[model samples]
Target chain A: MKEIVVISGKGGTGKTSLVASFAALAEKKVLADCDVDAADLHLVLNPKINYREDFSGGKKAKIITEECIECGECEEVCRFDSMYYPDPENEIPCVNPIFCEGCGVCVRVCPVEAISFDDAVNGEWYVSSTSHGPMVHARLGMAEGNSGKLVTIVRNKAREIAEKENLDYIIVDGSPGIGCPVIASIAGADLVIVVTEPTLSGQHDLLRAAELTAHFRIPTVICINKWDLNPDIAEQIETAAKERGIKDVGRIRYDTAITKAQIMKTSVVEYTGGAVSEDIKQVWRNTIYALG
Target chain B: MKIAIASGKGGTGKTTIATNLTATLASMGKTVQLLDCDVEEPNCHIFLNPHIESSTAVTTPLPDVDEEKCTGCGICAEVCEYGAIAVVKEKVLIFPELCHGCGACEMFCPEDAITEIGREVGIVEEGRADGFRFIHGRLKIGELMSPSVIHAVKIAGRESEVVIIDSPPGTSCPVIEAVKDTDFVVLVTEPTPFGLNDLQLAVGMVRALGMPFAVAINRSDVGDNDVKEYCQREKIDVILEIPDDRKIAEAYSRGEMIISAMPAYQKLLETCWGRIIDIHRNWGELTS
Candidate 1:
């Protein structure tokens, strides 16, 4: 099966909106929203979850206070500054879970062995049925890290389901930023579509996203959403893409109906066969052609 | 008060509000600093146009194993949490991208062969624009150490009286690292289903960290009233509201700050800062 992942280095560039439209247009496909920190594809897909699984990523260190040595060895060795003394006068170092990277430096340094390393639940994932087809998505717990690991799990599960159902495509909605999560989403994908707007930030992040795809040796194309918002910048982006050997698959004009369709919980293609829908269809067609 | 303007969703006017508000504060004769902690794709430089006074590489440590002293007993590999190390036939392999540089491997190595070395992951820049200080980070492409760069940006400008941080969009580690120590946070979001969903996640994040926060809705005229209703039910103070304005969009596309592009927004943003200060003062004694 052919795999395509949609990402935008800058957020609010219509990545989820385009992925939803692709789900409606594609014949047989499984959707996976790898943007766990902000998974918004489900808002429009309306998935009926059939399978749920809790995802545990890495381990965290907890200070065993009762076994207290009060030696302050753990605090001295930690690089993340996760350990802090609640009371400066006379108190044991408490673990700030947010700053803790689960590096286990404190656990190993504790001379009295007063620390325990254990797995922590980071989030949950699901296999669900939607109007498009079976989909895979996840919800990250609040104040949790290791989002890259969870994204990998979602991708693997989506691929497995596609293999079982003999699906033709797997369209993944990836997160913004060129970080661990974005890398995990594009690692083994067959194609990457970067959706950007005509703003200055959009132009800047588009290059960064393209550089990431190039680093991974993944074939990538560009889709300019809300192109009419800044036609001059859009034209400049086209020239820049040409110089970088990237193709402009589509340039969707700004449409108020796009958000209106989102409020209705439907894709643009399903809501109306208007100009914006045609633009997205063109993106899909050009993308499939490029994949060949 | 030190405040971070953040959103769970991107393109929600976090940078716009941050730049304009800081400019307005500068006009009001406040000592302010703006730090763009969104290392991967920092856009504040595009609008603010600061003259970078200095550029320095932000480095992360990587374990360099001495082949002769290395017995490859596998203790280092066993202790690694990120799977960045592997021992094969008395040889070691290191995946630089996967390493978190927590000094776990070197600390646990029994053979005394492992040593830490520095690698450039990104760069931190310090500058100024219009009488206010500016700092930001730019993470190298294909690198995963954005949090480290973010930490550097925060540290570089921690002493300002009115510090405003423009954080990357998300509810995960990078976002947490940016907004955690700040006294106040402004969660910028739109009024749509996606916007509301992501905003809820961002809210839960700041709340988990025990940080006081408010909401700012962009494009408030277009979407449903679910976001407004959610904030009201939760008693979240709606600090700023900017309706769908094409002129603002046009100015932003040209990399122009709102306060500069349209002088009319000067009073609006100044008033917005007034609310932030008022709300923060009500939270009792301030830290730092």
Candidate 2:
């Protein structure tokens, strides 16, 4: 089966909106929302969760205050600088969960063995039922690290469901940026579609995103969402993509109906077969053909 | 005070709000620093067009195993959390990209065969944008060490009276790294369903960090009123609301600051700043 991952380097460029439309248009497909930190495709797909499990992306260090040496050894060994003395009176360094990278060096250096490397419930993954088919999604907890690992878990589950059902595709909605989570979503995908806009920030970010895909030797294309907002910049972006040997698969016009459809809790294609829907359908057709 | 303008959703005008606010405050003769911490994309430079004075390489430590000193006992592999090291057939192989520079392998090696080496993942550039100090980071393509670069950018910037940080989108480590330690955070979001959803997550994130935060709604007229209603119901302060104007979009599309493109936006931004100061002072009183 082929996998198509939709990404946008700059956020709010309509990646989820397009993915929701793809979910409505595509056949024999299992969806994956790999934007675990701030997932929005589920809001559009309205998935009913079938199964879920706590996801432990990595380990975190916890210090036992009672059996403390407070030699400051753990603080010195922690490369992440996660250890801090919240109360100077107590003198024991507390591990700041947000700053912890789960490297476990602090645990190893604690002379008194007061540090315990414990599993952290960083997030949760779900196997859900949607109107299109089965879906895999996740929710990375607030202030949690290891989002890339959670993304990989979601994709693997989607792949498993697709293989078991003999599905044709796994369409994934990826997060913005060329960071760890975005890399995890598109690293092994069959095709990568970068949904961008006509703004200067969008254009700048698209180049980096494209460079990342090219570095990974992944087949990639571009979709300029809200292309009409700046037709001149949109044209310039398309020209730049061509110079980079990246295909411009589609240009979605700025439409109020798309947001209205989002509020209505359905895909644009399912909401209306109007002008914006037509534009998305064209993008869908080109994406499928490009995948082949 | 250090204030971070961030959004859970990308292109929700984090850069726009940050650039405009910094520029406006600077032009009004306030000492401000703009720290663009979105290393992966780093688009604040596009709008600000800062004159970069110098760029410092942002490097992370990677374990370099000395084959000669090694017995190939596989102890380093056991201690590494990232699985970056492997003893294949008693031959050590090191993957520098996977190493998080935590020094676990080198620290735990019985023979002390492993040594730490520098790996350049990005660069932090310090400059001057208009009347304010500017610093931004550019992450190497395909590199996953954005947090390190963001940290370097935050460090590289010269501290000023009002520090405005433009953070990356999302609620993960990179975002956390960019937003941490700031006095206050301005959660920038649009007024759509996706915006509201991501805003809720962002709220959870800032609340978890115990940060004093306020919301700024961009393109407030476009999608729905759920965002404003939610903020009001939650008793969260709505600091600023920018209407969906064609000129604002046009100005942003051309990489022009909103205050420069439309002078009236200057007042809006100034009012936003006033609100931030007031709210932050109140927060300080309560916390202290």
Candidate 3:
């Protein structure tokens, strides 16, 4: 099966809107929102969840209050500053779960055996059925760490569902920036669709994202969103893409209907019958064709 | 006072607010230091037009295995949680991009063959634009972690009297690292559903960190009243409201700070800054 991820170097380049429209156009595909930190695609697709599972991305170190001798050794060894003196009166040096990276260095350094690693439920993954096909998605907890692992879990679940349902493609809505979660999403994807804007920041981030895709030897196509704002920059981006040998898939102009559709909680294709929807449909077809 | 402008959602006007606020403060002749904490995509320099004085590489350590020490045990790879070290074909491969530089692999290598090595993950630039000192970071291509660079940027400008930070979009580690120890946080957001959802996440994060924060609604007329309703219900202060003006969009398109384009907004921005200072004062009293 072919796995395609729709990502942008930066966020708010109309990735979710385009991905939702692609979900409508794809023949047989399972969707995954690998943007676990701030996932919003489910708002549009409105998937009917079939199964939910707990995601334990890592362990959280907790202080055993009874055996604790607050020698402050854990705080000294913790590079993440997860271990802190919470109570000055009680002299209790405790672990903050949100900041803890579960390095296990504190556990070994604590002489009183006060620290113990416990399974941290960092997030939740869902197996849902959308209007298009089965979907695997997850939501990372607020102020929680280990988003990359949660993304991997969702991708694996999507692959398993695709195999069971005999699907041909896996459409992933990837996270913003070149971070751990983004890396997890793009590691095994067959193709990457980068949705970018014509602004300088957009172009800069696109270059970084393209460089990363090239490093992994993954083929990529660039789609310029909001191309009307700066046509000159758009032309420059196309030229740069040609020089870099990255395919210029297409461009989507700034359409008010896109935001209106998002407000209505529906894909652009479903919300309106207009030029933007047609443009997204064409992009999806070209992407599938390129994958083949 | 150190104030960070951040939102969990993108296109929520974090940069717009940050740039304009710094410009207004400078116009009033207040010394301001603006740090762009979005290392992956630092755009404050674009709007601020900072003349960079110096740039330096920020390096992090990765494990280098000695082949001659020659016990090809997979133990080093097994201990690494970041997947930076991998055993491939009887040899160890180090993917420096994935490495967090925890030094655990080197410490745990039983063969005493592993040593730490430095690799550049990003660059930090320091400069001045208009009247405000600026610091920003740009992550190296294919490098994943940004909180490290964000931390470096924040530390670079912490000594300033009034430091303004433009944080990356999201309520993740990068955002957290940018806002930690700030005297006040200005949460810039829109009035859309996605805005409300992510704003709540941001609120939860700041609260968990024991920080004082307020909200500024950008594009107030574009979506709905959910954000204002949320702020009211949560007793969160709504310090400022910027309308969805095409002039603002046009100025942003040309990489112009709004305060520079429309000088009238300077007074309004000063008011916003005053509100921030007042709220910060009240918060300090309440917390202490």
Runs in model 2 deviating more than 4 A are B284-288
Tens digits of per-residue lDDT for model 1, A1-292? 9999999999999999999999999988999999999999998999999999999878889988889679988988889989888877776888988888898989888888989989888899999999899999999889789899999999999999999999999999999999989999999899999999998899999999999999999999999999988888999998898899999898998998899989999998899889989999999999899889
Once fitted onto the true fold, the runs of candidate 3 whose alpha carbons sit more than 4 angstroms away are: B65-79, B83-95, B105-115, B284-288
- Candidate 1: list runs displaced more than 4 Å: A87-89, B284-288
Which docking band does candidate 3 fall into? medium
Q: What shift in Å separates residue B220 of candidate 3 from its native position after superposition?
A: 1.7
Here the TM-score of candidate 1's chain B is 0.97
Candidate 1 accuracy as lDDT: 0.92
Best DockQ among the predictions, by candidate number: 2
Across residues A233-274, which tens digit of lDDT does each residue of candidate 3 receive? 888888888789998788887788887888898889988889
At residue B176, what lDDT does model 3 achieve?
83
Give the clashing residue pairs of candidate 1, or none.
Answer: none
Candidate 1: lDDT of B175?
Answer: 97
Scored against the native two-chain complex, candidate 1 gets a DockQ of 0.86
Scored against the native two-chain complex, candidate 3 gets a DockQ of: 0.56
Residue range B1-288, candidate 1, lDDT tens digits: 789999999999999999999998888898999999999999999998899999999989999999999998998888888999999997999999889999989988988899999989999999998879999999999898799899988988857679999999999999999997899999999999999999999999998998888999998898999999999998889989998999899999999988777898899888888888888887554323
lDDT of 2: 0.91
Comparing 1 with 2 on DockQ, the higher-scoring candidate is: 2
Worst 10 residues of 3 chain A by lDDT: A77-86
